[model samples]
Target: MPVTSIVKDPEALSLTVHAEFPVKVARLWDAYLDARQLEKFWGPAEYPATFTRHDAAAGGRSNYHMTSPEGEEFHGYWEWNEVVEHKFFEVTDGFAHPDGTPNTDLPVNRMVFSFDPTPEGTKLTITAAFDSAEDMEQVVAMGMIDGTRSAMSQIEQVLIDLRNYSQTFATEAELVSDTQVRVVRLVRGTRQQVWDAHHDAALVKRWQYGPDGWSMTKCDLASGIGESYLLWWAPEDGGQGFGFSGKILERVEGHYESSTEQLEGGEEILGSGVPGSVNQQTFTGTTGGTLVTTLITYRDKAARDAMLATGMADGMEASYARLESIL
Candidate 1:
């Protein structure tokens, strides 16, 4: 994790974030100035950002939007007030409408990003000043802290050498918020290959099952938006079986997909102490292969915690590792 601490000062009407990355100051600075790298970590895992235009020079404006798994878009803009290459930059960040018009109804913030070389690597500090304590508290209540932390924690992956982040890397899960968790891994396959492996019944049957002694007994797949799938697994030794059923909510071929998932029996399963969740999966083609990120949004904090406690990520990791081997 790159972010060290996030401090709030009511008297100063500001929120400051401190983070250090093991990289040169120039490299850290470029990650911010370049839209390509910026977008990768600008928003949280589930809501990915896209910068339509970026100009960090003085008097320039950068426009971007983050799209939620449900297709909602949140727009924002940064009006560059000052720029000092490899040192610091100042901008007035504000909320905007989908059409790019400024949304004055929402509170705006003035942000300053400072970069300095450190003994370990580079230190980056960001201070966002607000007009009043009311505005500052409002943003905090809107989950800004967790969102920023989730976004900043992803910087390390973007900063690492591509060779070090290849298919050999193990799967990892990061808690983004009380109700969300992000799992990521590098697969030894192209984005299309990964997508196909997930959709093809034959490939899915080969790897989607759990650990040793378990076999997938049924695989009813759904390949398009608004479709549904049912997958069941049982122990080869005749132990009890369980299954998952989900409905595809969104999809962008070879890139991203989102679906609502739950235990097979719906109300019957819910009554037995299981809650539903939404999963968003995104695949990015990397130099080595494909990077797969799955963001799971649980019904509540308790639900999220329970799901994680069930060793779901561990099972997924084993399944993904098996997929890579077959690929």
Candidate 2:
């Protein structure tokens, strides 16, 4: 578990809580914006919190309540003051009534959440300022520190759940025929962005490798019909290298692209005379993002089964996971 530190500054009438997560900054930062994700770790272990309203933008307001073991409810609300994407945000937080009204008698604290990218991952620092030292001391004495620590302890698991959910969300592969396989995923970008990521050599090099300890050594992409392209990958340990080269068969700018991809120099691994596949990639705009569908047509059933045996679906999933980071 990552260490979570809580510090109090009486002179400044502030309390700061710090925690580090072994996840990308964007993922960690997104947790706050997502209402469902926030409910997973917004309170202590025993007292689960529920969000009634979550609007994550500057001037937005959020209302939530935590239920105690005895079924008592503690409501809270946040008035967002500033929001900077993937970096930090400021909000005024305080106790509220069950009907989403603030409790004027309770202490209102200003909280600033700072997300810093570290070598290991992301470090999140939460600085909360009260109107006076007495107010800060009053909250601290009410087990605020312990409650925060307990809540922060759940973040690691939340991140894991988010990752697992992301890897499986809207991702599927099915064999449509003996000679064809369709793979689909909801990519987090527009059609043009997804198209550029696939066609641009620089972006392709960042996510072409499907697994760890392998890197794309060379990638040459020509974006027109009848153009030629080559992509090569080498193991980090300088092991055997493999690649694919082919000519584009069809292209529709940001909508679709098709090419005949032939594996090069993998006879030992894939067996002799393994035929190539016609790979077609299609991108469509969706309400949430872009829907990317890949169709691979093999020469015959033998070629399709051979490709499946290579765990091609798993490789595609892994590669898409990498692509999600860049997008």
Error of 2 at 54 (Å): 0.8
Please give the RMSD to the true structure for each candidate, in Å: 11.4, 16.0
- Tell how far residue 92 is off in model 2, in angstroms: 0.4
**What is each predicted model's overall lDDT from 0 to 1?**
0.81, 0.80
Off by over 4 Å in 2: 166-327
Clash count, one per candidate: 0, 0
lDDT of 2 by residue, 1-327 (tens): 554788899888899998999987877876776555688899888899876555555666777899899989899999879887688999999999978899988899999999999998999999999999878988888889889999999999999877754333456777755787777787888767888889888899888874688889989887688889989888899888888899998665666667899998867756665779998776655434566767788999999888888877788778877788898
Per-residue CA lDDT of model 1 for 1-327, tens digit only, reads: 888999999999999999998888877775676555688889788889876545556766677899899989899999889988688999999999977789999999999999999999999999999999999998899888999999998888888842233434578877766777877777888768998999999999999887788889999999788889999888899877788999998776666678998887433322455668998776655555666767788989988887777777788889988998999
Model 1 worst lDDT window (10 residues): 161-170
> What is the number of residue pairs that collide in model 2?
0
Alpha-carbon shift of residue 132 in model 2 (angstroms):
0.6
| Clash tally for model 1 | 0
